[model samples]
Target chain A: MDFVLDYISVTTFWTVLFIVHALLAVALLGALTHQAVAVWGPVRLASTPGGSAPGFVTRFRSVFAPSYAGVVCLLWVLAFIFGAIIYTKYRIYVRIPIEQQGLFKTLGAFELKEHLVTIGLGLLPIYWYLWKNARNAVYDSSRKWLTIVLAAICWYGFLTGHVLNNVRGFGS
Target chain B: MSAAAQTQSAPSDRRRIFALVFGVSFAVLYVVCDMAALPMFTYHPGSDRIDLGFTPARPDEGPAMYWFGWIATSALGAFVLALGAALLPQKAGAKIPLALAWIVPIALVPVLIYSLKFYWRW
Candidate 1:
């Protein structure tokens, strides 16, 4: 940890790529969250006393809930590609040395991050299908679970990426 | 309930099954190849491991090939898996197997994490 500043130097190329990757991850995070909220809800005005109208924001998100699927899937893959590129440096330099230095907890967190991201990739198709057919009654239960799971994965992955990047700037 | 409607709907069913197979296969194969094939081919900077005939890419070189390998292997896997899954019965009740759609991906969380054992050394 103490050596982080001394050894980690962010090059322009890596920094630019990191920015692009982070932006994509953030966009993916927003899309997934918006979609999930649409699924799990917007404190329905109908559920409120006197049964008022839903907010404009809630109405708008719900309308586009089915659309987030493809964008999320695409961004998820792109972010992973960027991460993979950055990972080449992390694997040899940052990660190995961190493990060698015995920062087990930090390293373990990153391990979980990698696992979650890859697992998220696997989940995309089902997630896409569930959301695409969100209007259908048969897939109701599965769609709920899938959306919740994907959102959770995105949240975890986003936080983990940020934490790791802060610890040692992406491939610096 | 007309003949035209029946003809139209049949292809959608085929497409669904095809999508299921291709998607499942792509994800599974990508994970598998990432763990096995890509690592085998990527030349680690400092290592004494013998290359069994096939040359590995230099650790610092050619990231494109690694990415390419991932896409190509998964495409190959998807083609094969789609063909196999398509051959299965497409009866209404038979879609029970597509449950693997959500199941396998969820299951893979642990499997992918386990591969980190090589790195974690714990």
Candidate 2:
């Protein structure tokens, strides 16, 4: 009984993390599935010219649009804040004793570059692309594609930078 | 159809596709990142520092404050996206996607509240 209790105590954070993780996973799947159904499915169905817009699909897309966009943006922001909180909770940047101080110094320098500096630089392009496309009266395919590409790059940089900064358990 | 012809042929369809791609890609990226960050959070209850991913600290000191902060941030993002969705041209064909976009944020409120209050101690 004592052992089980100890295990639970040690792993409580994992359980919480898993629950939150799972919730996020489901949310992502739902967003993807909803988008797939709303966007791709209808286009494929209406392959023939002037097919009257696949009645039911048309109705569904109109109803789903605002909710889909709003939810996605909300999720993105929440994830970023949550990640930031996690970073704050863990002394990920602190120097562990017995390690060469030089290594910690190197990591500290990298951390600033990766998180603060790089993120600021990345955000400029992202915001610019978003703002530029947003200003247009109609959705320009070229601009839209550019926004997607920029967003993908930003997401990659953000995730990779965070992961690299948090490496632990080895030599600690 | 020619490129220009295709462009003119189905404007609504293209818009719908764009929204779907953007939404799905962004959501998947978020999920992957959150999962990757989970392991760092594993720690003892009373430990001074809790690992969240990028940094470690004592989050328990003020859980309520951060919880509300998360909600406010999420709300702001949702509002901005919803406003954009609202500005899109209204057509019978565009209704379902628009509605879906709006519904996404509404669905999140419950989830965020649940997670925030998950292990509350007061």
Candidate 3:
């Protein structure tokens, strides 16, 4: 442990964790995108139970929505955890430069992204339970709109984080 | 009703109400706490200090992070509301418009964005 510690530095550690964080965000992005699309787009639903969801778009929406629920929740949490850890790095490194440069809109966007992610985290349990059991009939529209909203939040968070990185990436 | 039927219905009702209560309460609480700056604690990154309750940074303390504390306050408040779901009547879930699960959050989006006006130059 002491030997490995000597071989590493703070920036190196943050960089590794940040890389994992980005990868998790990408995975989370993909999962949420698919689930959101399937919920909104025309597809074979569990209620209906049988049909060929051919074509590029149709097959994309054809996957079972429930399966994505648990995975999305899991990935959301994991990405959030990693992001939270790397956040200090962003604060100390990237954010000071951003703040100094007077990018208020960019800073504002990131601020809102934090709120969006927190809200999404709180909503996960309910979202998972709804999708887990009732993805149809009375709750069909509920599931659709809920998925869309969450997906939108996620997309915003991802894109904002991406843009911020472009402005002043880690270890800046 | 039969025992099995009663058992099944109870959980379904509980779940529905729990989801509604948690979803609506969390969304509203987060926004309210944020706009009001009612954080549970403040983290001053420069001074490396964690001050309980929402507080402005002292001189030379640098930018304080209240976002984490706001999240804490909202999550705590919303969890209490969700817990209260158990005391609700079985049919209570039906009374809560299901659309609120998404509607409240969507409505909050604009408000959340607007609250950042201080950060916006436009």
Q: Give the number of the best model, judged by TM-score.
A: 3
Q: Ranking by lDDT, best first?
A: 3, 1, 2
Write the number of the candidate with greater DockQ, choosing between 1 and 2. Answer: 1
After TM-score superposition, what is the CA distance of residue A97 in candidate 3 from its true location, in Å?
1.3
What lDDT is reached at residue A44 by model 1? 42
> For candidate 3, what is the total of clashing residue pairs?
0
Q: Among all windows of ten consecutive residues in candidate 3 chain B, which has the lowest summed lDDT? A: B1-10
Candidate 1 chain B: minimum summed lDDT over ten consecutive residues — where?
B45-54
> What tier of docking accuracy does candidate 3 attain?
acceptable
Candidate 2 on A1-172: residue-level lDDT in tens? 3566665663465335434633653464355345434433333334578655556656654344224544544444554454444443333323232123434433443233223211222122223333334434343433334333324433443444444435542122
Interface RMSD to the true structure, each candidate: 6.1, 12.6, 4.4
The TM-score measured for candidate 3 stands at 0.88
Choose 1 or 3, whichever is better by DockQ: 3
Residue-level lDDT of model 3, residues A63-132, one tens digit each, is 7777889889998999899888777567767788888899989999998898888888888877887787
For model 1 chain A, where is the 10-residue window of minimal lDDT?
A1-10
Model 1, span A32-76: residue lDDT tens: 888888777644445466766666776756656777789989999
**How many Å off is the CA of A14 in candidate 3?**
1.4
Candidate 3 lDDT, B1-122, residue by residue in tens: 34443344324477667767887898899999988989999988777789999999788767788877887898889889887874677666557776888888888889988998988885
Better of 1 and 2 by TM-score: 1
Tell me the deviation in Å of residue A95 in model 1: 2.3
